[model samples]
Target: MSSERPKLPIEAVELYNEFIHGGMSRRAFMTRVQGLAVAGLGATAVIEALMPNYALGQQISKTDDRIKTSYETIPSPKGNGTIKGYFVRPVSADSRSEKPSKLPGILVVHENRGLNPHIEDIARRVALSNFMAFAPDGLTSQGGFPGDDYKGGLLFNKIDKAKMMEDMQAAAEWLKARPDCTGKIGVTGFCYGGSVSNNLAARMGADLAAAVPFYGGVPPDAEIPKIKAAVLVHHGELDKNAAASYPAYDKALTAAGVAHEGYIYPNAVHGFNCDATPERYNKAAADLAWGRTIDWFNKYTRA
Candidate 1:
């Protein structure tokens, strides 16, 4: 089967992005979708095409023998009382006689829609790359993801933003302290998770070895000097709302003497790295960005 995503109208994709990111109401999104409908492709069809297809984006299967996965709950006194995450690690090469070596850790943060299947798959991919991965559910305090992006987004909004950040920090600390970890940690997240990654880079200081925030918001100017981690930033050329702040952010990082780099992928839009959302996934950009991400982590967080 061909892996190419279907061609979609840019307007429809942007509308969907806005809706999912809380910029547009569902009623407004439906109305806009109706206006964008055309022959054979009604509003319903357009919505279906734009919605996330988790199966399409899953590069690794849960049953894959190369990795072992589990759910873990860690204390988060500063945020939610407890947070649960999907933890994954590469299986030992000599499963019959040897234990896996301690590995560098990567915290895989999700978008506003909690820890969905796509994010779990991402954690698995991190494990395949020879790192331990943990993806905490931002909505864990609200009964978890509710199994749908739209609903997940709603639940995420209910979470106290400050508390959410605290939960992520607690997760990072927990992951780094794990016996299987090498005491070095990196973070990579998309959309909301991307923002969290950047924030954690600032808040965790020397505790964070690296951070890769894809189309995430930049930290405040004051927070810039506090970042001790090597940072790699990714932005989509067409995601003007998010990309607009990159220049200033890059300049601030430079002035702070922070180690960092940034890239803007041409012809890409918000969520371009997310293959689950076919309308927005830019394969070339995603591939290039992923390659850079792994390299950055290895350079900074390798045990």
Candidate 2:
């Protein structure tokens, strides 16, 4: 029969120190600490640093108090076809006073799930942060409503990449038309959206002040050299889905001679910034990344 036993919080460290001091043989110590979690506890602590606290999972309460803004469905001639986007800008008295007279704009993209709550919330959050953020319905032919279930599964399979770019171009045109907009813009995205941001910065040249891709797949090897904007790429080191190419991406960015910042959180898995995924959420890393994003935009897009 196996019995489960718990060890003191600091016992693991003491056992290692005892080994070093020759007070106990390594074999004897290993047997005694086998089920004591000497290694598992340490691994969990390290994971906690790189990942979000399971305790804080309850702290995130959803609310509809997010800032509101206007959006227009428009046609595009740039890529595949017509593209529609949800646009957000500052509205409150405090925002008008503290924000720049002419603010820069941001293009927010959606994940494979299509234009949903998380994507919309991101756009609203960007507006709240004082920049004009536009989240284009990445799937237009499929559907245009926020949070609506779409017919197609993956965006690339249904929507042509070229057409998506054209649609994005139309959305950018809309932002440029705004009187308060400064004409400088940036692109950022999560998951599949991140991949688009990377590819766009390489494919689309004009008006991009910065590019921030979070846990996105990278573009082709040849496309690496085409990147034009200052890039900030975030990834999960432990992300099985995205980490395979992380090293190659780092090399590509370095070889391309682009000014970029690459962050790979040690134990973080895919979608660390996503509040929906309890396993992948990392509050500390998310906040830090967000702060960096704000500073990056401020540096590139400030009026």
Candidate 3:
């Protein structure tokens, strides 16, 4: 066997600092960062561009407040002519049982994997957090499933952003009609879904109360000002995928005077919340981000 060994600990940091000073390629930085495996910090610190305040110092009380989730199909002018979606709502706190049925609502877009178990689980999670969460498969026509290939990925490739927004608009209208739901609405998602969230908020006009995108591609600068909701953005510091675009998006939001919070998880990579991908999963970061998302919606949508 060859006698090559890994780079030394001190040497690694020195190399990283050199790359930082020289403004070296992101690929080189990521490769070096992942290999170092820095102590106490995990691999995340190496790739994260900067450190975020890790102040999950408060205790989360387990309360009796409960929410329920379900699936429905609504008519829309899309590829399949029907928009299939999933939603979560509060069973007890719902206004329908009383006189007014308005409740804060949320639309969750899915990653490239389409409408899979993980996406449904996210809906349930959002319900538990007290918002009416709805997830519609942006690519329902053509083939079906998002996680697997149908008709050689052509169906997913044909996803039209404008139509997806229309489908979501229908879903929001459906919520508006529900006596158990409030009219206020927000949108959020991860990866391809996150990018959709950005585009959707801009297209949905002024009604959206909030928007949260996690590691998704950003839309153009002109589109940022059209976003009416307060936005919360999550990015992986070392992520090779979407890092280059997020800073520009953040700058645009700031310039537009939009209320927004953006966090870049250190040493994290793409798919940090995906437990199935252990290689990319970072429990601490995912948990923190989830709590923040809940807190954000609660602040805006509380009755």
Residue by residue across 1-303, what tens digits does model 1's lDDT show? 866544668899889988998988889999989998455677888889999999999999999999989999999999988999999988876433455478899999999999999999989999899999999998999999898999999998999999989999999999999977899999999999999999999999999999999999988889989999999999999999898889999999999999999999999999999999888999999999999999999999974
Instruction: Tell me the deviation in Å of residue 88 in model 1.
Output: 0.3
Q: Which ten residues in a row have the lowest lDDT in candidate 1?
A: 92-101
Compute the lDDT for candidate 2: 0.68
Q: lDDT: which candidate is best?
A: 1
lDDT accuracy of residue 58 in candidate 2: 35
Q: Which stretches of candidate 1 lie above 4 Å from their native place?
A: 1-6, 37-39, 94-99
| Candidate 2 minimal-lDDT segment of 10 residues | 46-55
Clashing pairs in 3: 44-266, 44-267, 48-267, 102-181, 102-182, 103-181, 103-182, 113-146
Model 3 misplaced stretches (Cα beyond 4 Å): 1-67, 78-80, 93-101, 146-154
Model 2: per-residue lDDT, tens digit, 198-268?
Answer: 88788765557788999888988988888878889888776655767777888888898887888887766
- Judged by whole-model lDDT over C-alpha atoms, candidate 1 comes out at 0.92
List the lowest-lDDT window of 10 residues for candidate 3: 51-60
Best by TM-score: 1
Candidate 2 Cα deviation (angstroms), residue 263: 0.4
Q: Distance (Å) between predicted and true CA of 162, model 2?
A: 3.3
Q: Which lDDT values do the candidates have, in the order given? A: 0.92, 0.68, 0.66
